[model samples]
Target: MGSTEEERPEGLLGWCLVANVARETLHGDSGLDLQHGTKHFSADALLWIPPIPWDPGHWRWPAVGRHRGNSRRYINMVVRAEDLENFRVKGVYSEALVRSLNGHRHDPAAPRTLQNPWSREQAQSWADRWNQPREPVRIDGRSHPLLSVPNPPPAELRVNGETLHLAHYGTRGAHYSRNPPPTEQP
Candidate 1:
């Protein structure tokens, strides 16, 4: 018999749902967050979505600690090569975030953040501005460069009621096995 849909491999890029539902005794509410829904990833890199809190003053805990869980639930995907390329081409560029994706430790001075790539319309506007050069203008006692549109940096994809962030890679090590405790001989 041919392989089923579950037997296929995911492409080098694109989004996928990652759910982790490990036992509660070993973890806390943190495991529940990962159990909720979809996520995106490249071949070896995972997208780290920032957590939103109901109260801006209080820091959210679940999203930050999902990694402590030991179990996960996800479906395998079969993706085309071209689709992967599309993601890479349109993907946002962040030097710090990219470093983390490549499995490097985060730099203290450079907190990782996602900057979305320019959209077609936005890019066109930028081009138009550059094409027609003009003198700088003074704003709030500071000279602003001509054609500067201070739009927030681009970020890709907005999941309903959820925030997405870039993943940070840190020191990696192998899991070590411990020796069994001494037992009485029969």
Candidate 2:
């Protein structure tokens, strides 16, 4: 199957949230399972997740909540402009029918608490300002434009006994392994 008009990101940048599925499934018969619905893009097409500051006191956008009592980590990756597909700005963090399971905690009295910080308009403007199509940076005299989230969670996290590194498709920061610091971890 091919991507529909709604599945296209148009133009956006930030992180891509990829489900932990078999490579074949992601590229073959079964496509991506997004918050909106199941949608198919190119094998390289990414599901854009806007970069909001990590609030230690508030719920994180892509919280690594538990699954069967173990930490459930999704593949948070960065991509060059050419690799992007479409953006799912609304309910981007919801899992299936569950709304914003990975977003801000619900508070009915304060309905804004449940909303994502960036609106679609804001995201588009951000993309325009920060994600303009630029030539790849040359590193060590070679083009290495890929850059991952600075200070990502440890690559040592285990999922089903397999070492699961949440960040991919880019270079890790100098403080990558030392982060979440000590205070950030619950």
Q: Which has the greatest TM-score?
A: 2
Please give, for residues 1-186, the per-residue lDDT of candidate 1 as tens digits: 757334433322211111222121111352233222223222322322221222332211112111223223222222211111111112324443333332334355544432222333444443354334222222223332321222221122123543333121111111111222246999
TM-score of each: 0.17, 0.29
What local lDDT score does residue 178 receive in model 1, on the 0 to 100 scale? Answer: 24
Error of 2 at 161 (Å): 49
Estimate the lDDT of model 2.
0.34
RMSD of each: 25.3, 17.4
- lDDT of model number 1: 0.27
Lowest lDDT sum, 10 consecutive residues, model 1, at 168-177
Where model 1 places Cα greater than 4 Å from the true spot, the runs are: 1-115, 137-186
